[model samples]
Target: MTRYIAYIMCPALLCLYLTGCDFEDEYNVSPRRNFESLWKIIDENYCFFEYKNVNWDNIYSRYSPEIEEQMSDYDLFRIMSDMLDELQDGHVNLLSSNVGISSYDGWLNGYPSNFNTEVLRNTYWSRSQNYNDIVKHNRIVDNQIGYIYYGSFKESILEKDLDNIFSTFSYCKGIIIDVRDNGGGSITNSDRLASRFLNEKTLCGYIRHKTGKGHDDFSDPYPIYLTPSHGYLWLKPVIVITNRKCYSATNNFVSKMKVLPSVTILGGRTGGGSGFPFTSELPNGWSIRFSTSPILDVDKQHTEFGIEPDIEVDLTDEDIKENKDTLIEEAVRILLN
Candidate 1:
């Protein structure tokens, strides 16, 4: 059996690798064959089948009959995309040059958008004296509290960037790290930013890969840890502001920070995408990306759905009208008191 270590972060373009199984003979351009290939690819690797309580065999029974040799690519794509949506995962996507991309975004669609970029930038972040593409940092609330707005994890954060940010906040009582509407990018950035808040090595989460074709066949969970950065550290009160849009790498960051004593996760629950996504190609030249490995919180619990905040907050219409972010105000209030 071949084994590979899966990284627990979300990158812009995830590296794709062929599955260990040989499909040379099955690569013919038949609709049924391609349908089976796609189903089998997901059946063998998708991490959430058992966790989500999906009946894959039942799903096959229902959809397999729909495949026809003469079916249009649009029809086939619709069926396959619908079948994938049954998993209700945001990380799952099917891409075809002929039909475009199909994805399940219901994970974030129905929830309240607790974050507003206009309000954040115009009301609060506009006051920042220091700003960069990766982060916006400044002292606010009578210069007693430090504020940092990190919009995306895709951007890299150098040690000097964090060093400067922390040094600027050295005199403040506490810090607010707002990551609302951050759709996630790289886990490397998440860890680099998180390391500064830790005083020691800590167990942040666990991850396991599918070891066999069985939905339940998974390796023992491996512990994930966060070690303190050698650079400046923040041992004082720290508030992490999150929302439904804080997904993928952002979700992982919140999971890690929630376990720390000095950090409090405020705002709404994180938009979770805890699976380490991997890609597989179908015989028809189409490709699918899905959650391949399951990542659990420090307690060995699934955060695939989301991680709850210590204090749940939503942006109010009144607050929006006044150009105030309720979550930020709440964080400032918590940090100040």
Candidate 2:
């Protein structure tokens, strides 16, 4: 009877010890814990820290003092949002009920307004039939240069649509692909459009992703190639117009297309967002997203800041008042000459 009681008590004591250990292992969902978790997530997974030359440890030391156990949720969110703003990347974002942050101000704020949609529409798109399509192809410059305006990469352009659009512009002198104010969308869409401009398999750029939690722990870069479209490939000269708003996939398009022999990039510098973002949650259930992959230009340099045009041109006030787009005029002149 004594042995049986001892065995039963031993099992009970072991169970209690395991339960206590588990309790200690699980983090309490407090404001401090939430802030710590968010900080660590970016520290481990963010890809641009070294490229951006940011000291992660110093950032932590600076912001950690602001976090307290008794801090309100809104206050914690603000702290985290401000902490992420140090990255200076438009791809980084944090959102909660009380706060929403996207780091676009660093690159776009106070820049020259290079684009006027009212002017573009009144000048060119007004002449296009079915102008509301995802891809609009209009014959401009007195039906000599084919003009294609892509508003966003988010909208998918079908092969059939490309076939028809290209067929419509088959007799033009050259083509102009305008992607101004395009915040980027589907990589596939950009690739789809690029394929139409290539005649052979062309090496455009490279991409890499985080393979480990360390900031610099990324996989070997992979080459991105663009193959000529099987259906309708444009062999004529093409000009791609861009501005500060051309980001993400549009940035990728400019990076790749600039390398082509018959392509010329015009307008202001491109709004660079080469990072492919991924998301995670904090202890408070707020979602935060950041870039974990880096897209490099053909020279294997980061284009996160923006890509310079081959011929840098900005819309001038004098030209705008005369109902003329300086960028458009430049592209047409380049094509015509």
Candidate 3:
């Protein structure tokens, strides 16, 4: 039998694989069947089992007995959600209109939320003379440093927008890009933003997808490159502010930026969701989204947990009381001296 492979492009430039088997036809709409279906979907395609040290067979042994023909939908959802939580990934979620969305936030639960939007707006951006929907840009610290607040990657970033922002800061000594609390949205947008800082085509990361049903089944990692933008470029020193909320595409952005000679990451560690997520439907018509492809950093290392900052700084109570963003202050000081 000849096996054919096809690709579906998802956010973060992830490739989803469609192989020769019809795994969906093997199950029915019973409670036990749905349970098996969910388990099998993750078993066959979820990418982090070996990396995370999870014995999926043992997981099957533990959760299989919980399924019953007469169990309530809520009970089944609870069990399945709990099972996914064992993966401890923020990108994994189970969605149903009946039970709403079941998510696992263990990835961000205990990490310090080093970002405070109120402090940022009131203390920093409030002084900005110009702002737009996607980015807020201005000069700070006696008008010697440029500061840009990019809250989310969901908003579209255009070349003209970047040109305008960079032009405004042409004379500044350096720039600060604050991506704290950015939950992530589009990898295309993140890459577009990162391109402005690059001087050449650079290998930013790698990605691979499952080629078989085995836990270790995956293709050779493919190179992911980021080329310099043709429009505006900033070769000056740059400091990126990050926090626990920087995940998915945001995490990818940080990983790419960290490799550049002119970029320095500051603040807390990022919230990592390095897997490219894919969706599969259960027998009951509910959908489950999970990590199917693993993405690696420039050194071929897994950043599934997160990427540490070059300079780690957290918000102090005293700084909070004074309405000062410690990370921003540190970044400004670095840029100055």
Clashes within 3 Å, all models in order:
0, 0, 0
Question: Candidate 3 has what TM-score?
Answer: 0.90
**TM-score, every prediction:** 0.90, 0.90, 0.90
For model 3, state the Cα shift of residue 184 in Å.
1.1
Candidate with more favorable, higher TM-score: 2 or 3: 3
* C-alpha-based local distance difference test score of model 2: 0.87
Candidate 3 structure quality by residue, lDDT tens digits, 217-294: 999999999999999899999999999999999999999999999999999899999999999899888899999888
Query: Which 10 consecutive positions of candidate 1 have the poorest summed lDDT?
Result: 1-10
| CA lDDT of every candidate | 0.89, 0.87, 0.89
Error of 3 at 315 (Å): 0.5
State how far residue 247 of model 2 sits from its true place (Å): 1.1
- Native-vs-model 3 lDDT? 0.89
Candidate 2 lDDT tens digits, 145-230: 99988989999877887888999889998999989888899899899999998789999989999999888799998998889887
List all candidate RMSDs to the true structure.
9.7, 4.1, 8.8
